[model samples]
Target: MTNFLVSSFSLSAAPRNSVSRIQQELTIAQKQVATGRFADVGEALGVTVGRTISMRAEMSNIEKLKGANTSIAQRFDTMQAVLETAAGSGENLMSSIISNGSTDEGIATNRRLALANIGQLVGVLNSSYGSRYLFGGGKTDTVPMKSDIVNDYATSQASGTVDTAWQTFVTANAGGDPSLVTADQMKSFLDNEFAALFVTGNTDPALNTWDLHWSNASSSQTQARIGESDLITTSASANDDGFRNMMKSYAMLANLSGESLSDEARQVLTSRSVETLSTGLSQVTDLRSEIGIGQERISRANDGLKAQTFILKVAIGKEEEVDSYEAAIRVTNLTNNLEASYALTARISRLSILNYL
Candidate 1:
């Protein structure tokens, strides 16, 4: 008791829509085969979109960290080379003084060589990388030590503030011999005018390079991000006790070079001078050792960063990469479906009103 009415136009339109959908699927599969990565990452990763995005971002950050770490490591290497060479020169100067019976000319000549070596060391300390001074701390644009440090020292020591005090103490109390200056007098001079040159950090406006007005001692150092969870620091300046003691010894030895004193005075000066220079050598040696330790830490951090990068790459690849074999199979199936759709459409289009009747 039911009458069925079906329009040919409606029937044709429904098949056409199904054929269009099959063609669209075929196009997507072909694109997946051509590009190893999904054409639509969000559509391909449906529920895992957030996680894939995070992993990719982290991998990008790790790449940037690796680049920065390479630069820090280079600075560390240069630091070690300069420190070792300076320490060696200090040690050599002390050794020559200890085993010398040469004339004042010989001593003076040695002092001249030492002065040049000290100046070279200062240049290394102020070395720059890409317009930024290595030892300048937060003031990378500024030189950390005065260019005329040796000259300033000569002026200060000769003005009776340091040399005169030592000379006066030795003359009055040291048996009329300048070389016989006692440790008390030496320490006193160092505590007063001597330490004034370097101690408590050079905050004087007159001495801009030696100024210690940094946010913090460590702030003067370079902090590098080697990994997601790691930071490495390295820095050194003329104010470091190692450099201070070494430069002080050099200055004093240089001053003694110009003095017209007896062999007894020279010998006395030489022995006492040898002692201080030896201590400076020890401090510089320790700084070189610290550089070795810093290099080791950076090496370890680099390894960790590499491992993290690999893990992130693997995770991201799984979410975004197209499976070549699977994609090929899907392409074949879609092609067949499209061909069948075309055949059906042709057959339907061929069926006119007369054929239907």
Candidate 2:
């Protein structure tokens, strides 16, 4: 009968509450670490490493494209300057030929000298940028003028006469003589033939007959086209009337060997030379303008690419970067909650049913 009055005592909820709070803090810390928001040491280390890797790749691509754009622009600029010089030289030579009558032996000498200048101009037409021939059309490895001397001319040897020889040269080598071939022909027999040769029927957009070419191997095919014209339909049987007219004019001038020719013949030949040169200049100018247009297009495309690359970088940054202020606040709050939880848990453990009794 000495049984103590049975009293049921329940433990206070502080211990459970403290455990729950501590668990919640741990969850928050885990989430922050995983999402890269809070500055948990492990999470911060991981985020920094990943972000550095992503940013390096993005930056590298941007830099590479930028360099390519610069190279393309510089090449176009150089081509423009060269064309300008060629045009000026042509004008000066034409003026000299027109003003000084061929009756003067000096006129023939001057003509030969001018022919040399034209040969120089042809050399310019065969200019290159990094291994690419600028004027060989799609054949970027071969020069546009193989020889500037008429005697060394390929077509002249084949045809035996200047008129027939050049026609043969153009037809056989250039696929067909261009309508504007008069000005492009060799000035002397010692000069090499002027013809555009390309890999047969190869119509790659970047490859034109005026461009240089090497082996058909993939490694050697990185050349670019520089000249403006590449006829889609080339025919030897069909007459290049424009080219024929130009050659006729050149032949007329070439035949005037001595000062004894009639005044009318001299006048006609001089007039023809002036006219042919003028026509040739027009063709060259037109081609140059076309090149300018191509250059503008490439520049615009490069600018657009740059803008897009910048936007991509911004997007990448948003996805990977952490806000330091937000991370710091979360870390502080988590630290405080964990400390409070621990204190509350200790206090609860001491308040058992026996302690209360």
Cα error of candidate 1 at position 227, Å:
2.8
For 1-357, candidate 1 gives per-residue lDDT tens digits of 999987777767877898889888878888889987797999878988999988888888888887887887888788787777788788778777666544766787667766765676666667777677766666667776654442443443222344655565557666666555554555554455455544434455544222432111223566667776676666665556776677667766675556655555555556666766788778878877877888888889889989998998788888888999999999898888878878887777777778757
Show how many residue pairs clash in every candidate, following the order shown.
0, 33
Per-residue alpha-carbon lDDT of model 2 for 1-357, expressed as tens digits?
A: 586653232233655665677677767655665666443434545645566466657667667765765666676677778767767766776777766765576568545645455445545655677776554444556654434232332233212344454456557644553332333233332134322222223467354322232112121223332222211110010012222233333333443323243454455446656776677667667656766776776666566667767876676546555665675576677777777767865665565466667
lDDT of 1 at 18: 86
Which lDDT value does model 1 have at 164?
Answer: 58
- Segments of candidate 1 deviating more than 4 angstroms: 1-31, 150-196, 201-220, 330-357
